[model samples]
Target chain A: MRALTWQGVNELSVETVPDPTVQSPTDMLVRVVRTVSCGSDLHLLGGYIPFMRAGDVIGHEFVGEVVEVGADVRRHRVGDRVVMSSFIACGRCWYCRHEEFSLCDNTNTNPAITEALWGFSPGGCFGYSHAMGGNAGSHAEYVRVPMADHTAFTIPDAVSYERALFASDSVATAWTGVELGGVAPGDVVAIWGAGAVGQMAARVAQLVGAERVLVIDRVPERLEQVRRYVGAETIDYSTQHVGSELLEATGGRGPDVCIEAVGMEAHAPGPDFLYDQVKQQLRLQTDRPTALREAVYQCRKGGTVFVLGVFAGVVDKFPVGAMMNKGLTVRGAQMHGPRYIPRILERMERGEIVTEHLATHVMPLEEAPHGYELFKDKKDGCVRAVFTP
Target chain B: MDGSARWTAALVGALGIGGASVAATRAVQKARPRPRPDRWHAVTVDRAPADLQGVAAAPPEPLAALGDDLEIDLRPAPGDRGTELRARARRPGLLVDADVRDALRRSRSLLEVGEVVQPDEPGTTRRTVTSLPLELAIRHGREGGRL
Candidate 1:
């Protein structure tokens, strides 16, 4: 089977690998139909995540048809069209019981790796580096899905495969941000980065009754998409002062909730950008928190700041005083995909969310490297690149 | 001695007997059978193949030869992803109908939701723990991925 393997920094190749077989009674084998490139993949591609190896397959968000089911997999049958949550959960742990699916104690087969990193380990995530369980990614003809009953959902007939693909990760991720930030009626929500996740976050905020939603980015097309498709105000940070503009728009109160959808490798303007760049290059800091810092700085006092961007390591010069003195609340999570993907699917069915536009470029799985390049460079307004196997 | 002295001596003797009776009752309670923290499993470091030993909750030597419906527990070290088995289990295994690990995991599901529930197909992966950097801050951030 041909799969995209991560060779090294900025290197991706579609190589032939052995096809996956079901190894557990609770496992199912899925022939992938569509797998999409994620912005988080950029962190892995850039060598920011150190756990990635030369032959590791890379992709997470995907939808497919169940070709085989293990003996214990009761919920799904062969030929079922399913969308798998990026995060693999046991669906039996204490955390899963409380709907904290990502934090499931049993699913991370490589708990020590994550336990060494995060105190305890989180549930396994597909193709997200060894830190997230090192499960083979979905960017292949067939991949084995462990704990299939809860991690993979049968897509409703009303939802298209393209839209269902987003529900696997992007939509659920944005919904997790909204759910965590507690977007409320009449609240102003500001999201940093107008990429796929941020775009979805903006729409989700509106769907949840946020009165005003602002998306900030320097990319013209992305800002335009946010304005048009997502129905949110846009801010070109390169042109206007994001903080001042947000403050003025909110009548000086600042956005009630600020979501930082841009992660560690953010490109920021000014002297601090250079500071973070040098530090990042020298390996002195693991992440560049320009957008996160700005989110904390620009949020209204006592408001919440939800970080949706992936930060693999520590950041330098976090404004603890601002976070403390202003009585700000900070929270973040890997998307509890299994918990929220169903709700996202319901919303998608109701026509409250449309995702076909996010798949700006569609290509064969063999051309995955090109997809990555176009997405990394933001070429052709490619918010997401969906690949068919 | 006067009547007052006699009365005081009687009172002191009665108090002594009362104290001894209380102490005796506590001793009897202590001697009665009480539950020890259930050690249904014990940890060992011996390198062993669990599948070869079958489902014996007890150590190989004692329970290996006896096959009267057994249960076992072979797990990875608490924080170490199953690089090596933690070498644990109990003897006179719990009357379970499945492998010890599966039984415990299933029982957990049943207790939590009244049925064994799963999100994905249950399958096994080779337990390989590659040597990676183990900085607390590095691993901690990966938990509950903030992004």
Candidate 2:
């Protein structure tokens, strides 16, 4: 099996690895048809995330055909077209029952010890770092999916794999942010960082009937794309102040909801400051204070702020006072792809939300490293880069 | 001096007692206050520093600085002024002006304590400083600044 592995910082290699097989009664083997690079994957490439070792398969968002199923896998059968969730969760766990699949008791990626009989220390992830349950990822010809009944959703015949591919992570992540932000009819929503997640979030906001959706990003082309396809108002943070623009657009009231989509490797405005200095000196490659600070400063009072972006480590100088004084509601979690995939697929099938626009480029799996580079550089209008296995 | 006089007197007394009881009940109800939709109201404060300061006191001068074309008006309360802000901008409307107010307010706070400032806006950006014994809020006109 050919898979893209993380060799080191700024190093990704596509090599022939052993094919995956069903290891547990709950496991299933998927022959991947399509996979997309996640914005979070940039953390691995930049070495921002911890414990990402060499030869670790590096992908989490993909659609595949189930080639084999385990004894306990009842919901899906062989040859079923399915989109696998990024996280592997036992549907029977307390957390899974609550739809908090990221925190599922029996499903961490870290190796389990006797003391932790059921749950692994690292949360289960497809191709994320070892810190996230170091299970085999989907960026290969074949990958094993644990908790197969809970994690993989069979796509309807009408829905194309190209559209359903994002259902696993990018679209689901945006849906998570939208749900957390509590978008409603006639509400004004602002999303920071017009990456794939941000674009999808803007679309979701529209689908939920947000009266006005404002997407902020420094990239002009991406903003234009969002405006055209997602029907969202774009704000070039490079030219305008995001916080002020949001207030202006919302009539001196900041957005009723704000979503921070630019996670850990978010670019800082201007040169390195004290916080940047500390991070640089500490050899930390991740942390973006500007975006989070702006989100806090720009969110409306009594409104919800959802953090969907991945943050690698500690963040300093967070504005806890503003959050407290304004009576704002802040919530964040990893996207429960298993929970959202079905809803996103339904929306996609209805043509209410288009995931196809998000795919800027598609290439063979052999060009996986190049795809990673393009996405990391954010060049060539790389909103999303898909690799076909 | 007979049965008719006694009946009238009893009826008058009964009416007086019933009226007094009704008045007492009304007073109690007024004192306790029942939940009503009209009574339930919420005031949202925008996280922008300028708006926060404006609601705390008077509107800032930067807001007032917006020009007349912007149609900047200040309403006391419970008016649809906020709605007007959204309707005004079609193609890059009042968004720039609002941003300027936020920038001015941010810059003012940075200047108040005599801190060396790196201007958010490039070149020699100008600001009119007014010092009061305490903080005096001033409102800006729409389309007022060089934004």
Candidate 3:
């Protein structure tokens, strides 16, 4: 099977790799139909994560057809059109029982690495680095999905494959942010970054009844998308002061919830950005937390700040004093697909949430390396690059 | 070498290099784990302490996977966490920490979820020069975590 593989830092190639097979009773083989690039993929491509290996297939958000199943797979059969969650989880674990599927105890085959790094491993992620779980990603013709019954969902007839693909990760991740950030009816929400995840977070906040939302970004294309498609006000941080615009939007009380969707590889504004970049390059800090710091510092007193970004390790300047003085709540997590995916799919089927517009560039799997180039550079207004195998 | 042998050799080589880098660069979890003295491998399962001790009679695969010369004890965890299953080798040199930790983890998962979920085998990589360290950490990782 041909798959897009991570070759090295800032390197990718489409290579002929071994086809996957179902090895566990709860496992099923997914014939990849559409796999797309994500902002999180940039960390891997840039070698910020440090766990990636050459020849490891690289893709996660996808919609596919079930081509095979193991004996204990009771929920799905071959030929079923499905969307797979990026996170692999066993439905029977204590975390899964509590709807925190990302924290499942049994899924990450390589637990010690993360347990040693972050004190405990979360769960296995497809094509994510080995630190999460060294599962093969979906950037191939076929992918073996573990715990298929819990991780893969059947797409509704009303939902197109393109629309359902986002539900596998982005929309679910966005929903995790807004829902866990505790967005309430009529509350004001401010989101950092206007990428696909940020736009989806704005949409989820609106769906959950946040009356006013503001999306901040420097990219003119993304901010335009936020205003037009996401129906949120935009702040081009490159042009206007983000703090001033946020204050004006919320009428002085500040946003009730501030969500940071930009991860470690954030582009900072000026000299301070270089400070973080240098520290990160020097291995002093594994992440650049410029957006995260802004989210924490600018959030309203007693408000909630939710992190929806992919951060690897320590950062230089996090605003702990501001958080402590302001009495704010801070939280973050990987998406719990089963907890939010069904409703997201239902919304997609009903045309309540539309994501086809996010696929700015669509091409064959062979063009994945170029696609990554376009996405990593944020060129050609490429919100996301969708691939067909 | 045939394909399988080449792949295995490459993976082992990567693990070797990665193991050394993991110790040097990461600055924690010595690439080589020294078994702690008088330390017991323990897991807190959602099941009751009594149920875990009783399961040893008709041992599950997780417990059975460990040899017969193991001494096991179960007690309620503090703060209502769950039952704590503690075990150690009956003899001085029977099992290493990794073996005991791995067995305890499997036993807890088997009792709690009925089966230990795993990643796909024959996986997706051929193990590259750069992929070695993370690969090695993962290879030795099944023994729970630093905790």
Candidate 4:
């Protein structure tokens, strides 16, 4: 099988790897039809995440067809077109019972333990790294999926793989963020990071009946895309203060709900000396506190703040006092991709959510590294990239 | 002897009865459990991947003793062995020896590391001792007994 592997920082290559096969009773071997590079893939290439080794498959979020299934995989069978969740879950744990698949008790993709299990990890992304369950990614000709019945959802024929791909992660993550933010009908919502996830969050917010949606980002093209496709009011953080813009957009009351989709590598200008210190710290306090802190401070009293970004290590200096003083409710989670995949697929079938617009580029699997670079650099209006295997 | 002696004996008997009654009341009072004080401290730590650049370190002072009643500790990785903190209070008639442990078994941050500490043993003095991964232990110490 051919797949894209991370060689090192800023290094990637298309290499031939062994074909994937069933490894567990709950496993399924999917013949990948389409997969895409996520914004998070940039972290692996930039060496932001440790233990990502040479030749580690790097991609997550895809739609494919099950060519084989293990005996215990009763939910799906051969020839069933499906979209996979980014995280592999057991689906029967206490957390899964509550639809918190990301916190499954039996799963190995957890951030803390993944490094020991695999060379690298990314919250259990497909085709990303070994640390993320090391299950071959969907970027290859064939990929093995563990806990198949729990992680893979059948995609209806009415939905195209291109449209269903985002359901695997970006759309699901955005929906998770919006849901966590407690977005209600007629509520004013603000989203930080107008990337694929942010855009999808805006779209989902509208679907869930948000009265108004505002998106913030520095990329002019992405901001424009949000305005044109998502119908969201946009603020270029590069040119203006996001908090002030959100406040103005919400008539000075601030948004009732705010979502941070940028994750750990969120860009903020500061002294170069602070960069290393900031990168090593991963708590909610110091990791990209600007947008999140602004969200906390600017949220309407008694509103909710949802953080969907991936922060590593410890965080410092969170605005805890303000969160308490304003009576703001803050909640966060890695997307329970398995739980949301089915729902997002149904919405896609109804044409309620248009994911195709989010895919700005598509290429063969061999060019996967280039796709990562383009998406990372935000070049050529690269909001999302799809890889056809 | 005389009528006066007889009267003194009778009064002494009555005083003995009163003393017995007081002693029984004190014993019952001592047997009852003491009410626990309302004291809490909020603690939070990052549970993200370790390799990512800019991953924040645990607080310089992770442990804190708040208001002389509550203590908190935060760490980087709560670890496989799990971690715990002990909290205690003093009250009359309480066993004061019973240990009280509140196991934070279902924390998202704790992951597989179960039981922040075994649930507090009852009847002990009010003192909270938290045991977590080394990073959090140090962090708690640096926080000066505040969350």
Candidate topping DockQ = 3
Model 4 clash number: 69
Q: Give per-residue CA lDDT, model 3, range A1-389, as digits (tens).
A: 89899887898999987778777778899899999999999999988988877778888899999999989888899999999989977887667878888888888878888887788779889999888887888888899998899999999888899999999999999999999999999999999989999999999999999999999899999999998998899899989998988888888889999999999988878987999999998888999999999999889999999999999889987889999999999999999988999999999988889999999999999999999889988899988999999
Candidate 1 local lDDT, A93-185, one digit each (tens): 557766888887666645555554465567778998767776788888888898888899999999999889999999899999998998999
Among these predictions, the greatest lDDT belongs to 3
Flag regions of model 2 displaced more than 4 Å: A111-122, A271-281, A284-286, B1-147
TM-score for all models, in order of appearance? 0.77, 0.69, 0.92, 0.69
Candidate 3 segments exceeding 4 Å error: B1-36, B48-53, B77-82, B91-94
> Which residue window of length 10 is worst by lDDT in model 3 chain A?
A88-97
Candidate topping TM-score:
3
Cα shift from native, residue B147, model 2 (Å): 52
Better of 1 and 4 by DockQ: 1
- Candidate 4, residues A1-389: lDDT per residue as tens digits? 78777665698888887666665566788888989888777766775564354566767788788899988779897999998888777665446656888765444433333322222222345655433434455667777787778888999899998899899999999989988778999999988888899999999999999999988888998898898888888888778887777777878898999898877667754553265345545322324455676678788988999998765444555789989999999998889997788889899999988878788999999887788878888889898878898
Question: Cα miss at A347, model 2 (Å)?
Answer: 0.9
lDDT, residue A267, candidate 4: 71
Docking band of candidate 2: incorrect
